[model samples]
Each structure stands twice: as C-alpha cells, then as structure tokens.
Target chain A: MTWDILNIIGTIAFAISGAFIAREVNYDLLGGYVLGFTTAFGGGLVRNLLIEIPIELIWSQDYLFGIAFLGITIAFFMPDNWIGHLKKWVIFFDAIGLAAFAIQGADYAVSIQAPLIAVIVAAVMTGAGGGLIRDVFAGRKPMIFHSEIYALWAAFAGFMIGLDLMRGPYATLFLLIVIVIFRMISVHFKWNLPHKK
Target chain B: MTWDILNIIGTIAFAISGAFIAREVNYDLLGGYVLGFTTAFGGGLVRNLLIEIPIELIWSQDYLFGIAFLGITIAFFMPDNWIGHLKKWVIFFDAIGLAAFAIQGADYAVSIQAPLIAVIVAAVMTGAGGGLIRDVFAGRKPMIFHSEIYALWAAFAGFMIGLDLMRGPYATLFLLIVIVIFRMISVHFKWNLPHKK
Candidate 1:
C-alpha cells in the first residue's frame, strides 16, 4: 500500500513537471499530454525493458495513467501566476518523486536478482531517465548529464539495496528521506560533476 | 541466412552514419563509439522491448557489435575530404539499411502474430529509431519527424507484410528494392511531410 501511494505521487509529480515543460516549449495540447504521459512512465518503461520484464506491465497501470492525465490537465489549466508561485513546490515534489522512484526501481531490480551493476543502473535510469528523455524532446541537453548531483543519489540507493544493506518498508523509507535531503542540498549548493574547462 | 546478412549490412551502415554525425557534433572518439553503437542497435532494442522479446537477444549478436565498432573506427580515421566524397555512397547504404531493417522488423512482428498497427510501428521504429536516438543524443530535433518522407516507406512495407501481400524471400527482396528506390527518389525530389508554417 505504501509503495503504491509513493508510485502514484511520483507519477502525478512527473506528469505536472512534463506539462510545465511542454508549456514552456509552446507545444500544443496533444504534445502536452504526450510529454506528460512520457514523463510519468518513461522511466519505468525503460527499466522494465532493461530487466526483460513484460511490456504489458506498463499497460496494466490504467489508474496511474488516469492520474497522470488528471495532473497534466490541471497543470495545463492553471494560471501563470499560480504556476510561478508553485515552482518551488514543484521542485520539492520532484525531489520526492525522484527518491520514491529510485527506491522502487532498486527494489524491483533486487527482487529480480539482477546483478549489482544492473541494480544501480535500474535505479539511476528510473530516477533520471524520464527527465533526460523530456529534455531531449524539448531540444535541450539533459540536465542529469551536467547538473548537480542528481543520479548519483539514486546510484547510492541502488548500491545499498544491491548490497542488501537496506530492506523492509522502514529502511526503504529512511533511505528515501536521506536521498531526497541530499538531492535538495546538492541543488541548493549548486554542486556539479567535474568537467574539463 | 539472408536475414543475418542483411542485418550485418544495416548495422555497419548505421554505425558509419552515426560516427559521421558524432564527428559533425565535435564528439570525441568515445562519443563516436557510443553513438555508433546506439545508432546500429537502438532500433532493434526498442523493437524487441515493444514486442516483449527478451533483451538478451541484442547481446547475443556479438559479431554485429564487432562489425559496428569496425565501421565506426574506419569512419573515424577517414580524412574529411574522403568523407565528403563518400557522402552519396553513405546515403545509398543508409537507404539499404533502412529498407532491410524495416522489412525485418515487420516480418518479426507478423511472425509473432502481432496486430497490424504493432507491425507497422515495429517497421518504422526498426527503420528509423536508431537515427532518431542518435539525433536526440546529439542534442538536435529528430530529422525523421521533420525531414523527408522517410518512415512512410517503412510503413508501406509493413502494411504489405502485415496483410500477407508480400511473402517469400523473393517478394521480400522486391519490396526492399522498392523501398530503397522510393527513399532515394524522395531524397532527390526533396519530398516532405505536411506541417504548419
């Protein structure tokens, strides 16, 4: 039940984020819906593909799709001033979504008995892949590739899960909180990966 | 045996194409290799995922990967003037690759008893998805979405295969030739899909 709740929250948050980006790019309504749907589910879809899970699993989540659509529709209709005010909150929710999805992805990989590297990859991809795809579609460099320490936190969670250091709902919840805090701190500090000048 | 040969030809052509694009974008050798590999196999990867085929099928093609690497390496070492002179040949090989992959993808989908729409999607994606992914990684809009009538030929091929109008190796070869000629003609004539001004 807890996992389901977290998944729903993450889906709605990603849907709104995608809708906002579509609006920024001046995409039509259909584009907005497509982007919104992709953001909400693209990560999981990629993860499932990598893990060789049935693609039908994605189609089975009908309710989640409805929730994502609802979230995007609401975002589409919101006033500009309201969106401006919600920017910070959107970031906060995005962090929550990232954390939840990372943990869930790691858990799924671990359950499947995937190798440690695969587990970590599943986590990072599930956490950041949607945003990467979204940015690519919007004709921008993927933020995860150049921005603050984002996917690294997801990697950390995956490592812990792969090593069997984290298990159970409480432990998972604790890790999720830690990752969210670390991600937010990195954002606030403007931390970045090293690159050649 | 024929399918395997066609697959190899397509893979090498795509790898060279990808390496050229990576060079155009000023990516390093490593980037060239990555892009080349993606452009060679990303379409099949996506097609398999959509068709629920085991992802391991991609990894099993060890020889194809080696050929792709070789093709990219050759492209990387070639002088710029040589590349300019070979540009038309590259386009011709690319058309061959597109037709081969499209027919192969549609055949696979039909063999699996997938619906007509799925077969058509499989064809188009297998034909053009690698280039789409390559352009996205290069931080550019997908040319297939806006450029010449590339995927439509793939769709036409797929439709024929799905309806069982084209069967047997001889018929398949004929269709492949037809698609390649149509693609080349489209390029020469500057054919394009309709869009808003």
Candidate 2:
C-alpha cells in the first residue's frame, strides 16, 4: 500500500513537470501529452530495459496505461491555468517524487540482489532520468547535471532507505519526512555542488 | 553480399528523403542530423524489440552507424544541392529505401519463423517507422499517413518477400521498381490520402 502511494506520487509529480515543459515549449494538446508520457515513463523504460524486462510486458502492465491516460487527460484539459500554478509547486512536488522513486527503485534493485554499486546507479537513474529527458526535449539544461543538489538529494534519500531496509517496518512516514526535510533545506540554502568551471 | 548492397542502396535513398524533409522544415544542422538519424533507425528499434531478437546483439548490425553517419553528413554538406538539383528524385529515393526495408524485414522475420501476419506487420513497420518518427519529432504528418501510397508500397514489398525466400531477392528489386514507378505516377496525378475533418 505504501509503495503504491509512492508510485502514484511519482507519476503525478513527473506528469506535472512534463506538462510544465510542454507549456514552456508552446506545444499543442497532442505534443503536451507526448511530452508528459515521456516524462512519466522514460525512467522506468530505461531501468526495465537495462534489467532485460520484455517490452510487451511493460506495455501490458496495468499501471502503465493508467499513468499515461491520466497524464494525457491532464495535459489536454489543464493547459491555461495549469502551467503557471503548477510551476509554483514544482520544487516541492519534484523533490518528493525524486525521493520516492529513489527509495522504491533502490529497494527493487536490492531485492533482485543487484550489486551494491548497481543498486546506487539504478536508484539515481530511476530518480533523475525522467527529469533529464524532459529537460532535453524541452531544450534546457537538466537540473541534475546543473550545480543544483537535486539528484544528490534523491541519491541521499535512496541510500538512507537502502540502509534502513537492510537494518526493520521502519515507518514509511519516516522516510517521507526525511526526504521532505532534506529537500526543503537544500532548496532554501540554494545548496549545490561546487563547480570547477 | 547482395543484402549489404541492397541495405546501402536503401539507406542512401532514405537519407535523401530524410534530408529533404529536414530541409523542408528548415532544420539547423543538429536538427537535420537528428531527423535523419530517426529516419534511419526508428523502425529497426521497434522491430528488434518486438521480435525478441536479443536485440543487444543485433542492434548495431548491418551498415547502421556508417549509413547514419553518411546520412547525417549528406544532410549537412550535400543538402542544398540535393534539394536544388533533385527535387523530382524524392519519390524514387524514398521508394528504394521502403522497398529494401520491407524485403529485409520480411526475410528476417521468416528466418526467425514468425507468423506471416506478424512478418507483414514487421515489414511495414520497419520500412516506415523511421520516417514516421522523423515526421513526428518535426511536428508534421508522417509522409505515408498523409499520402501518396508509400505505406501501401511497403506492404506490397513485404508481402512479396515473405511469400518465398529464394525468389525474394528478385521480388525486392521488382518491388523497388514498382514503388518508384507508382510514386512517380502518384506525384504526377497529385494523389494523397484524404484529410480527416
């Protein structure tokens, strides 16, 4: 149940980012939905393929269509007011989604007994791939690759979840709280990695 | 030996069409190459995955990288002359690519023992997918969907190839001729699919 909520949360968060990017690009309804679809599934698609999951099975997954349909509908209907209002909450929503995806993906990789390094790699990619894709298609520099502490925060969140899981029901709420607090602090301080050039 | 030649012939033909479309869109160098790349590879990506080809092994097979590099180079350096001198040749070049892909895709499917219906579908997709993707990213209706018997020609070519392997080589050449002739006829008559209202 908790995992399901996180999945849904991630989907919605990415969807919002997708729609925002579309608005920024001045795409029509179909274009917006296409962007939204990419943003929501780009990460999972990469992750699944890397893990050698079959293509047909990915399409057949129930949550697949559910997320796509929801995203498309939102893009089609919410064009005018959505982009501006949505951008306001982007920092919060995106951070939550990133954090949730990081934790969930790390858990799945560990369950598959992936090597520790691979787990970290998957977790980071799963958390940031969607945004990177969205940024590229939107013709902007990706947040993670920028000096922003965005991907790092997600990585930290995923690492902590992995550590906690290795150690108890370890309240899912606690995980969420930790992610939110770190993200808020990071954004507040304009925290970022040091740049060489 | 024959397959290698046919594939290059097809790629050159497709590259011309890709360059033409990108030029039509007034794409910059990066955009033109990107469009050309999509035209060369989209269908194969879709087919390789669907046919469960252990795609990693087959992904870079044939003249993909060379042709792609050649195509993009042409799109960049040779585009102006190609567009100016050979406006009438688009139909022929596109026909060659489509026919070659149709035949090759059908043969590959049969070699893998796919159902005839599946073979037909794969052939059509492999022949058309790249151009379709190219069109989509450029925000235009796909050439086949918009008009002039392009996809139909692919179907015919694929069907002929799948009917028999030994005869398939001659049939591919025959299909190429047919597509070129028919496309020329369609262009003269200004034939097109009816626009949906």
Candidate 3:
C-alpha cells in the first residue's frame, strides 16, 4: 500500500537524521545506532502504547529495524567532508518523515476511536517522539519544542483528520505534501513561536 | 498488600525528587507538576507497555496522581533557604523509589513469564526510566547512565529476583534495604563509573 511505502521512507529518513545528530553531538558508534533506532521507532512505540496495541508487534517489523540500521550504518561510514552537504537535506527528509508519521499516527488513533485530543496528541507524538528522545539522549532540549512551525503542522493534520475533514489515500497524500511545504516555508522564513526573552 | 504500600511510597518519593529537580532547574509551576508526575508515573508506563499491560489502567490510580500533584505543589512553595537542605535528601528518597520500582517491575515481568533479559530490563527501566525522563525534560544527561552504583542496584535486584534467589514479601523488603544501603555507601565513597575524558 501507498501508506506502507510512505512509512518506510519516513523511517529511513528519520533514522538518518537521528544518526547525523548523533555524530554532530560526538556520540560513539553504538550511541549513533541507538539514537537512530529510537528516532525511527520511538514514536510508533508511544503510539502503540497510547492506543493499547501490543508493542511486541513492532518487533515483527523486520524491515523497519533493518532500514534504521542501514541508515545509521551509512551515516556512520559517510565521508567527513560530505557531512556538511548532507546536512542541508536532513531537514527536508525530516519534514517528510514528520508529515508521513503524523498522518499515520492520527490514522491509528482514529482507528482506535480515541478522543479528538488523543488523536492530535498521537499525531504530534508519533511524528516527533523519536526526535525528542534523540535530542534527550544527546543532552539537548528537543528542537521541536522551540522550532518554528514544526509540531504545529502535525497538530493541524491531526485536527483535520479528527474533524473528519480528511480521509483516504489521496487526502493523506495531499496533507503530507502540504505539511512538507509549510514546514519548508516556515524554516525558510525563520518563523518562530513567541518566547520569554 | 505490602507491595501496594511500597508502591505508594515509591511514587511519592519519586514525585518529590522530580519536583525538587524541577525547582533546581528553575522550571515554572506547571513544569514542576509535569516533571513530578512524569517521574512518579513514567516508569510504570514503560513497564506496562513492555509487559503488554493496558496503559489506561494507570488512570484508575487517582491517589497516585493526587500524591504527585501534592508533592510538586509543596516543593514549589518551599522557602529558598530550605531548598538547599532538601536537595541533600533527594538522593536518599530517590534510592528508595528506585529499589521499590525495580522489585515491582521485575515481579511484573516474572508474572508474565517474560524472558530473563526482559525481566532484567523491566526492573532497571521501571526503577530508572522516570529519573531519565526527568533529566531529559530538565535538559541534562541522565545521571544513572553516568553515575556509578545507581542502575547497578536495580539490576542486582532484578537479577536476584529473576534467578529465584529472592522471593516473597520479606525477601523484597530485604533487597530494598540492601539496595538503599549500597547506593548510599557508593554516594558517600564518591564511587563513579569510569568515563572517557
């Protein structure tokens, strides 16, 4: 299914992003893999718990684990000089992963007949939980908490889904594109949430 | 029956430790409550998910939530001078909570007939997960990962329980006391894990 493809892509993208961050933070190779794996799967783990799904089911997804491992391995072996070039694309990939996971997370919550608030929370947590854990492991505040137009986009997607405004493959695809575009625009403009100075 | 009492004591102790950390880190009133609640309940949440327990069951424990909230509020209102004195006792309380949760967590895994590794993981995670999350939310490295004799005590309890070397109410109580004493001795001796400089 198209959803499965998107999920795989998101997993790989997030895994790579997590590995890159790990390297940037000077983590050892094992640390990089741990962070990468957590980034790719932590959200789903959280969503599964929230929806009362058996988390053992995640371990059955061999491809998910394989892809994350591959992504981290590749990131670890890449040339040092190429790191800067790759960094530019990390955000784009991260955004795609975020959008894909956000919609998918909402879908899971909806399937479970969770409340509206729970649906929105599932969306944001699924999209961002791995990254948040990654940052935590790296001893930094999660960037999404302070970043411009990050978690909000996921919340918006969840809102629309919970409101019954979006459904089906086409709607999901459309929303995904919109989220990616909006995230890029916000980043480009350096838009930020209000903070206490 | 005794386990329930120990559980309540552990929850209150962990919640207070969380609130104390939040105060030390200068979090707002709401942040203190959030951190306190997470520290008290996050371990159980992790344990439940891992053991395939329904997470909603946690909501049924109204008194647990009440205790955590009360602990945070009290910590928030403490006079500034008293804060330093309270910090000295936080570790002692934290060690008690750790032992209580570790035994409980291992017991849950044993009840479920989980593998030995899973039993050990459940024990350590249930004992340490909350504190790790507390540090993460406070934007610091988790102390257990870096500290000597912290996670080890939980692991020891788990190992003994899993190996059937310890059992029953009296055995659990004995292990708890031993863990606390060992932790305090390590702290007094300034024992720490070797780290790469």
Candidate 4:
C-alpha cells in the first residue's frame, strides 16, 4: 500500500525530471520519451537484473509504464511558465524520488536475503542509476558522481535496513520521510562529498 | 574454437579503444581503467542479463577480465607516439570488434532460443552497446547512433543468423568475416544511414 504509492510518486517525479532535462538539452520528442521512460524505469531494471529476477517481469509492469508516459507527456506539453515554476522544485522532486526508490530498492535486496553490501549497492543504484543515465544521455555529468551528498544518503538508508536497525512497514515509511528531508536539507545547504581538485 | 579466439580479439580491441577514448577525453587513470573494462564487458553483461544468466558468472570469467585488464593497461601506459600510430587504425579495429561481438551475441541469443527480434536486438546491442557506454562515459556522441553504417552491419549479421540464412560454426565464421569486410568498406566509403540534420 504505502510502498506502491511511493513507487508511483517516485516514478512520476523521475519521469517529469527526465522529460524536462531532455527538453532543456534540446532533444527531440523521441529523445524526450526515451529519456523519460529510461529515467523512470532504468533503476528498477538494474535492480531486477542484480537480484536475478526474470527480465520479462520488468516489461510486465504496465502501471509503471503508464504513469511514466502520462507524466512525461504532461511535462512535454506544459507551457513554459507553468514548467518554470515547477522547475524551481525539480531538485526537491528528484530528492523525493531518490529517497523513495532507494529504500524500496534496499528492501527488495533484503527480501532476497542479499548481503549488506549488495543491499547498499542496490539502494544506491536504484536511487541514482536512472538519473545517471538521464544525465549521460543528455550529455551532462551525472550529479550523483559529481556533486552533493546523494548516493551516500541512499547507502545510509540501505545500511539501516540491512543491519536491522530499522524494520516493519511503518519503519520503512519513517525511513523514507527522513531520507527525503535529509536530501532536501543537503541540497538546500549545498552539502557535497569531498573530491580531488 | 574459432568463436573463442574471435571473442578474445574483440575484447582486446574494445578495451584498447576504451582506454584511448578515455585518454582522448582526459579522464584519470582510474577512469581509463573503468571505462576500458566497462566497454569490453558492458555488452556481454547486458546480453547475459537478457538471457537470465547468473550474475556471479560474469565475475567468474577470469580470462576475459585478465585479457581486458592487460589490453587496457598496455594501452594506458603506452607512450603517445605509439598510441598515436594505433589510433589511426581505430575505425578498422572498432569495425572488427563490432562484427565479432555481433555474431557472438547473436549466437548466444540463438542458443537461448530467444525470439528472432531478441536475437537481432542482442546482436546489435552486443556489437554497439559497449561503444555507447564508452562514449557516454567519455561525454561524447555515440558513434553507433550517428556517422557511418555501424549498427546496420551488426543488424545485418544478426538478421542472417536469426533467419537461419546462415548456420553452423563455419557459417558463423563466414558471416563474421563478411560483416567485418563490409563494415570496413562502409567506413572507407563513408556510408551512412539516412538521417535528418
């Protein structure tokens, strides 16, 4: 229930972000749809592959595809001013999507009895992989790799889940909320990972 | 077997291509190594995932990793003049690698009894997917999506194999040789897919 709702919201946010990014980068409509769909689904696709899930299961997620297409289409056709206001909140929406997906990804790994490291990898990859592909296809440096304390928050969520420091559906909900707030705060304060040069 | 030798040659060529591309784009040594390995392995990884191969099996290919590491390391450490000389033949090497991997990828799909479309997709992806990843990581346009008739040749080989217009190991070898020659000629003549500017 909670998980399903969060997943849909995250998918919508990611899809809209992908569409906007594609348009901003001057990609054609086909490019916009491809980027949008990939951004919405790439993470799950990667997670399923890592967990040895049947590939066909990914394509079978009709709701996921439907929501992504709807969101991206709306974003693609929306007027500039309408989008401009939303653009200010793009980072916020992206953070929400990331946090939601990250926790779910970790939970999936834990369900599969994956090791702690694998759980963390799943979390980070699921949270950020779509965005990475989105940026790469747009010819921009991936934000997860280049800036901000992003993947770390996903890792932290996964660690808490894997170590049994957190459990249960409500606990997962709490974790997701905390992660979203934490990500928003990180971006607001310009928190960043240390880097060379 | 003939296929085994061709795979090794293709791996080495792709790895070197990756290392050189990394250098050309001024990536660090670690980046060079990562890009190299990913370019050499990304397509196979994608293919294996589609075919539902165990993820651990990817790690178990000792010789494949060993060869990629050796080829990338050599390319990375080789002096500018040495690399420059090899760079001139990059297109030729890239075409050979593309043909070899395309046939091998199609063969794998056929072995799995994948549908004809899946076989063709496997062939083109296994041939061009690595280069796509390589270019994306290097922040350049993917050559497979543009320029000469690169992916078309890969698809041509896969189409023949999937339709059983070509059969057997010897026939596969013949297909590979013909595809390689065809790709080389296409490059020499600057053949391109029709596209809007």
Candidate achieving the largest lDDT: 1
DockQ values for all predictions? 0.13, 0.11, 0.15, 0.12
lDDT of 2 by residue, B1-197 (tens): 77677677677667656766777788887787777777876777666765566567545565566776676676567736656667566556666677778777777777887765557656877888687678767866445543465666666666766676436456556666776677677778977543211
DockQ class, candidate 1:
incorrect
- lDDT by residue (B122-192, candidate 1, tens digit) is 99889988988988887878889999998899899889999999999999999999999999999999999
Cα lDDT tens digits, model 3, A7-38, are 88789888988777776776556556657887
Docking class of 2: incorrect
Tell me the native contact fraction for each prediction.
0.16, 0.02, 0.20, 0.13
Residue-wise lDDT of candidate 2 within A1-197, one digit each (tens)? 77667667777778767766666655544345445766776676665566554544444445644675576566546647656676647667677778777776677667777766667766777788777766665655676787558777656655765565533336655766687778878788878888888
Interface RMSD of each: 5.7, 8.5, 5.1, 5.4
Off by over 4 Å in 3: A27-34, A49-59, A73-79, A193-197, B1-45, B54-124, B127-131, B137-139, B144-197
Give each model's whole-structure lDDT. 0.84, 0.67, 0.82, 0.81
**Per-residue lDDT for A1-197 in model 1, tens only?**
88788788888888999999999999988888988888888988888878776779899999999999999999987999899888877887788889898888888888878877668768877887788778777777656654577778888889999899998889999999999899889888997654211
Writing each residue's lDDT as its tens digit, candidate 3 over B1-197 gives 77677777788888888888888898999888888988899988877877776789889999878877887899878888887887767778788888999998899888877766567767887998788788888887766655566777787888999898898888889999999899889899988643322
What pairs collide in candidate 1?
none
Per-residue lDDT over B1-197 for candidate 4, one digit per residue giving the tens place of the 0 to 100 score: 76677778788889999999888999988988989988888987777776565568678879999999998988988999997688757667777789999988888888877767568767877898788788888888566654677777888888999898888778877888899899888878987654322
Task: Give the TM-scores of the predictions, in the order they appear.
Answer: 0.61, 0.63, 0.61, 0.61
Clashing pairs in 2: none
Q: How accurate is candidate 4 locally (lDDT)?
A: 0.81
